[model samples]
Target: MSQSNQQRIWQVVSQIPKGKIASYGQVAAQAGIPQAARLVGNVLRKLPEGSKLPWHRVVNSQRKISFPIGSPAYQEQRQRLLAEGVVFNKETIAINHLAWSS
Candidate 1:
């Protein structure tokens, strides 16, 4: 990706603070690219393992973690968020109380 496009994606990721969450579409929109929702997911998936970008705080439009059961990423993300007091309803997080500012 070009430097500018990389920066744009990072700009959106950087705005997501600790203990907060934003949907892919919202992040794309906030970055001034409304149609880049799936692109946002792709960019996030490509982030290096151990990035400080708070990648765990993002999820699908349904507010559920996307990784498959037993997957390391899924378990780690759920554990991390729960450690931060994020409440979940089965696969979905309670967005009304947990939705982040965009």
Candidate 2:
């Protein structure tokens, strides 16, 4: 994806409200690339540290964090979600309850 597309993805991600999450596919759709869900992940992974974008709010379609179990990224993502009051059912987030529609 071009830099502009990535920026658009970042802009869309930044708008996700606190306590709500969006699937990677949803972020891609909002960014005007409906089929680029994996691309959304790529863009997020490349985000600079301390970015204002809410990268943790982007989850898989199954409402799970994309990081591997026991990894630092997984732990951090879980921490951020919990801090935002996002409830998880086992390994899956309760996305139906907390998904941001816009």
Candidate 3:
């Protein structure tokens, strides 16, 4: 993807408020690159270590963390969301209540 598109993805992710979540598709759409959901995930995955862009606030369209279930990455994402007051029903977040609208 283009650097500008990547930056746009990051900017949208940065705006996801604490206790709120956004799907990859939502981020891509908000970044002005509709239908680029996978690109959004790729941008987030390659975020530099120690970057503070709130990457964990982005999840899959299913309202689930993209990381493998029970894995360390999954656990970390879950913990971060929990710490931010996101309520999960089983493995899925309560998306209707917590999804970020921007």
Candidate 4:
């Protein structure tokens, strides 16, 4: 993706408040790149180490972490969300209650 597109995705992600989440597709749409959900994931995956962007706040459309269950990445994402007061029901987040509308 172009730098501008990546920046747009990052900016939108940064706006997702603590305790709220957005789908990859939702982040793409909010960045004005409709139909580019995978692009959002790619951009997030490339974020630099120690970056302040809330990459963990973006999940699959089902509101589940995209990392394989039981993986370190999955655990980290779940932990971060939980720390932010996001509730999960089993492996899926309570999206209706925690989705970021913006």
**What's each prediction's clash count?**
0, 0, 0, 0
Q: Which residue pairs collide, candidate 1?
A: none
Local accuracy of candidate 1 as per-residue lDDT tens digits, 26-61 = 888887788888888889888887788877777778
- Stretches of candidate 4 off by over 4 Å are 1-3, 95-102
Q: lDDT at 85 for candidate 2?
A: 89
Considering lDDT, where higher is better, how would the candidates rank from best to worst?
4, 3, 2, 1
Per-residue lDDT of model 4, residues 23-89, tens digit only = 9999999999999999999999988999999999999999899999999999999999988888887
Displacement of the residue 37 alpha carbon in candidate 3, Å: 0.2
Per-residue error at 55 for model 2, in Å? Answer: 0.3
Cα displacement (Å) at residue 98, model 2 = 6.1
Best-performing candidate as measured by TM-score: 4
lDDT of 4 at 63: 82
C-alpha displacement of 74 in model 2, angstroms?
Answer: 0.5
Lowest lDDT sum, 10 consecutive residues, model 2, at: 93-102
Candidate 2 lDDT, tens digit per residue, 1-102?
456888899889999999999999999999999999999999998888978889999999988889887799998999999999898766777754655534
Comparing 3 and 4 by TM-score, which wins? 4
Per-residue CA lDDT of candidate 3, range 1-102, in tens?
556998899889999998889999999999999999999989988989899999989999998999989999899999999989888877877644645534
lDDT of 3: 0.88
| Model 2 C-alpha lDDT versus the unseen true structure | 0.88
lDDT of 4 at 48: 95
Question: What value does the lDDT take at residue 2 in candidate 1?
Answer: 48
- The CA lDDT at 89 in model 1 is 69
lDDT (0-100) at residue 92 of candidate 1?
73
